[model samples]
Target: MNITTPTELSWIILLQSLIPSYKKRAERDTSVPDAANKARKFAQRYGEILESLKIDPTCQGGPLDIILLCKLREQVLREVGFKDIFKKVKEEENEKAISLFDNVVRLNDTIEDEGKRLESLVRGMFAGNVFDLGSAQLAEVFSREGMSFSATCQNLVPRPWVIDDLDTFQLKWTNKSWKKVIIFVDNSGADIILGILPFARELLRRGSQVVLAANDLPSINDVTYSELIEIISKLKDEEGCIMGVSTSNLSVANSGNDLPVIDLKRVSQEVAYLANDADLVILEGMGRGIETNLYAQFKCDSLNIGMVKHVEVAQFLGSRMYDCVFKYVEV
Candidate 1:
């Protein structure tokens, strides 16, 4: 989606604005005991990135959102010895999201109608999106304890969403069967355990191979490949294998590049190979779907599901904050 009025989401604004609230966010989210100092360093390196982008940082530069600012942030974070800053955050949320899985699955199991169950599952995915650590704004609202999945689902007002593609999505799904699916995951914890994985489990139940493509390195609480392995590991019953995960039905791949943004045309070898055979592609979370691929053309059927975290961006796209989008485009 396009946020045309110009945002600090771009390289120029990032340098000009110097990344707002960095001191607060860094202190809160990072393990660097001296986040204030790191924020200063991070800002300095961010300026260097802007210079490399050929931007004066005062006037104009290349297109907004074209250059991945998350990439710049990752480099800065690593240089300051805060590579796994969100590690504890991911683990906590993953455990919390996992604890609710059985209850969510059980709720869907009681629904006799397949369509209704499927809709409920999709809702669960969106509800989990509220747990996003990507935006500190949302992280405060949705990740709190005692915030039940059903409660979150209940709060969702159906339709009139930022981009509602449910009718098209349902039409396609009802008529087709996918043998394999590639889910481009977003945040860890609820976003994965509650959101994407349940959908994958359902695909497995219906005879489909699923590959979870995660970041090779950390990007704002989004699960790393190794972290995803750990989360998947705990799902195993004392038996050495998770029920739906065995049979080679469910697997994970590293995106190879750790940036929060993805330009699939330049995807990693592992993701490229897995995506080559996948009949369906689902890109979840704000960065992958909203920020980068909101209008991305795919060679096959694709789904973009996420919530717009920034109100300015959301409004620029003719929506509002916390507005959910489920856009389905068939190639």
Candidate 2:
């Protein structure tokens, strides 16, 4: 969260970062008969928002940050008559991820070594991070390959990580268990279904209560409470779920945010109440875990998981694109 340079918050630079994906409406649905027209109208409105922001003489030469950008995006999307532009996309992603989730979990259960099994699951979190909206071009270009997504994720490995403290996290949590865990989720596709859900279930296996904290509304492709509930409801009906964690042991809490950025100071009553006993808080994705809460402090153990997806963020963190971070701290 250090302010290293003014360009880090430059409005123009941030807009440029999103231009390509916005132009084509990355991962957009054109399969339906009228879906193309719907997408076109949506994109037109989106472009109008961007244009308005650019022409705003008052906003000239302002310092741009991720939180502000996200807020602006949310506001514009709402005003444009589409509160959830990714509603269809999110649904598709959730469905695809849930369909392949059994295999994702099966791979981990096959690993005989306990530590390795845990490590593989942790890596799954990083691998699934490719589903980010900022990197939606990558997702769209590659196509959401469902069960075959794992092979694409393998490319993420063998890359230098910016902050890798998995060994330390394993050292502490392998034989120990926390009373409660707060899994701050991100993205709609495999990122949540294949990554955080399995990780949370593993915590459940160790007798930890889990609170899946998500957005109160929509922002980018970040999962919202409505979207998360849909996914959870599906998992509940599955027989012999991974780790056999009951759906009752899992709870959902809104973080009281409509944007991708998290403002921990104002969480929902549910999250505030559940987090009281939270000994482990896992903040996932670059927006929450890095941009806003990179230096966030708490009265308990915390873990920040993210993949550097944007150039500015990579430069700010002194990492490269797709570089993963596994930062752990106890306070």
For candidate 1, write residues 107-218 as lDDT tens digits.
7778887777778888888888777655656656543553666787888766779788887776766777788889998888777888787778778777788899988888
Runs in model 2 lying further than 4 Å from the true structure: 1-5, 8-11, 23-64, 139-148, 238-243
**How well does candidate 2 score on lDDT at residue 20?**
46
- Per-residue lDDT of candidate 2, residues 185-270 (tens digit): 99988889998888888777778888999998887788998889878878875663554666567788888888776878878888
Cα deviation of 315, candidate 1, in Å: 1.9
Top of the candidates by lDDT: 2
lDDT of 2: 0.74
In candidate 1, stretches whose alpha carbon ends up further than 4 angstroms from where it belongs are 1-25, 28-36, 43-66, 142-147, 238-247
Among all windows of ten consecutive residues in candidate 2, which has the lowest summed lDDT?
Answer: 55-64
Q: What lDDT score goes with residue 228 in model 2?
A: 90
